[model samples]
Target: MVNNTDLTICLFPKALSIPSGFVTLGICIGNVFVIVSVYSIRSLRKPCYIILASMALVDVLTGIFGFVAGLLFALHGRFFYFGDTVGWLLHKVMVSTIALSLLHHLLLAGDRYFAIMYPYMYIIKVHNRSVMLTLIATWTIVILGLIVILSPYYSKDVQNVLEYTFMILVSTQMYAFHLRIYCKAKKTAGQVSSSTCQAVQNNRSDFKAARITSIILGAFSICILPSLIHSIVIETQGECGRCRLPFYVCSMLAYANSMLNPIVYGISNKTFSDSYKKIFQKIFQKIIRLC
Candidate 1:
């Protein structure tokens, strides 16, 4: 007779496990490059790239947590291989890191918004120290908030409600901020004086940064929304037999987001892309010397 564990194992086929392993690896490797490029390149040591580096750090943690969970799932063919408590802890950590990533996106959007809309203020107020403080504050708030929401004091339903509400609010604010930035850029395009070539150049650079961030935001939204909706459906309707496949799909999509940001950065930002090329060239040279 087939046991329940066997059935569970069957549900999580090797097909899913194999791809998940690859995706987790991709997330870790891609984000590591982002962090290294940002750190090694002196030009990237600015407030904007600083925020991106922090985001990459958070994504690396997210990838680590996902890898651990996926390893257990792959080994046991079931989740929470270490038991429910450990599993829930891992889940909370994953959730928190993802929340941090989203918050970082929000920060990036706000950073660009201020840079373009209130350039004088941004120049005066936004610096490495200020950006670091904002990042620290963001981390503290999200960690504390997650601890509260995921605490045993709240029932599962309450936890779900709170999480959903937080995600929605943050996402909405990000959208609004990016929209304003878009409008501001459009309105100011013709107003910049051709006489001040430096001013025009600066304006163009700011807009380019804004455009890259917008693309990142769009990729994040597209990747995460399906997972968000899936969670809502699972909570309200409960998981049916058919839910298993969609659950895997949604999860992979969510995990894919961590890997997408670095790709977007490489493709959209010339500085980052150039750094990537140089890094690869150096790595190749090292391998050749070793041989």
Candidate 2:
């Protein structure tokens, strides 16, 4: 009567402990930094910024609470023991974090669609309450999804698989948007310096955000999907083999979402970029004076 925890024993042999430790640390520290950066901005008080901040916070938790710390349990095997409530909470938080991220992404896509398609007209229409509603709704959606999975009818593994699948599909919508942006940028290449083109890549356009979303969704579909499938199969069959590698890879890709938002995506528009540069320049000058 072996179970999922026993599966960890199976993975311990194949996983590169050294690399996993470093990777997990990298994700935890990097995501923590991004979340902190997002909140430090008084200008980032809008709904969209809140959503991004939440996502980064969860990414940090998922990396530390879900992966890096969870791995310690695996490394210790039967040597480590913890209270039942703590263990339950850990699993619950992990599930919630992953599901919530999916919901936040959907909201982000919706936000972009409105901003680009409507622009000035939309700004006048969206009041503060509307933003609050969107933020509340994102968590509501995640909670509802978790309630479905946490139901007595389904197993934990079932919930995990469904979460991964939902992420894959919803993310595809975002990727399609990014692809459209890429095409538009290509068409206007001569006029766009590489830096200028980069800035507009995810600015406020109907095509802008959707296109950037496409890039991310596309990456998840290709790089993250196979691993998710592997995970589902292993869970359903109660068998373990070469599955851990893909599962680990997919998890990392998902966690990388936080870093991607600030780096890979074109959220750094001219306005934001200029702001970023000015702040950094002042810091650099201060540093030189101190030296």
Candidate 3:
């Protein structure tokens, strides 16, 4: 077993570190784009879109805390800049963000399902004030959970177990939501015939939503499974010195999920795509005028 003192938590070889830093930088930028696009476009000011904006905010924080901070730690090779307390706080923030990100994915899936399955009820139940309250409640729960994780009540082993258990539960809930959405969408499509142009357009929109849901799930599973599996293995077996590299790689992959959502969901949607194009075009024209 590598002693906690001896084990370098964030250090990576030059080859790996450089690439990881680049990936993290890209994630930060992509998440920022999501935040900007959601707020800048007037058409995207609905409940579901507000949820997306909130998700992007979580992702942006994740990129900064999980990836960017880790990169800085790797570069410094120690906690010389921030000291031990900052490092500990960063670790807590990373875990908290990861939990929030997982919950947010499920939240998004549930929001979509509700909007599709109970459109009228959703309108009444999930209004702007309700959405705001829900978000606040979620963050409050997460913060409380973080307090427990940081408290001395749980030993390190217990903490690991709790974290893993939380993740497994979240994963299960997300999958259940995905399956429910699929079945509901299928049933809805079966009822709504594509006989009229409007009906056909509605069907196409549903299909697109399904495709986007699949992409989100696919990206999440790919990025998260590696880390989840690795964590489980580490928990089962005692610490292996050689496991550090793979753990770091898997962690990077998990954080990469933050980047993939904007590309898959935001750019794929027509409204956001058009907004993004206009935003970029204006920025370039301004640059040209400045020059």
TM-score of each: 0.90, 0.64, 0.86
Q: Locate the minimum summed-lDDT window of 10 residues in model 3.
A: 1-10
Q: What tens-digit string does per-residue lDDT give for candidate 2 at 160-256?
A: 6666677677767665544554565567555444535543543424354455455545554554466566766766776554435555566555545
Error of 2 at 285 (Å): 13
Q: Give the deviation of candidate 3 from the true structure as CA RMSD.
A: 3.6
* Greater-lDDT candidate between 1 and 3: 1
lDDT of predicted model 3: 0.73
lDDT of 3 by residue, 184-267 (tens): 767667556545676456555655665676688889999999888887787687567333778767877887888888888655
Per-model clash counts, in order, read 0, 11, 0
lDDT of each: 0.82, 0.56, 0.73
Candidate 2 residue spans exceeding 4 A from truth: 1-9, 13-15, 78-92, 127-129, 144-148, 151-153, 156-165, 175-223, 232-238, 242-244, 255-259, 265-291
Residue 94 shift from truth in candidate 3, angstroms: 0.3
In candidate 1, stretches whose alpha carbon ends up further than 4 angstroms from where it belongs are: 1-11, 80-83, 191-196
Better of 1 and 3 by TM-score: 1
Residue 187's lDDT within candidate 2 is 70
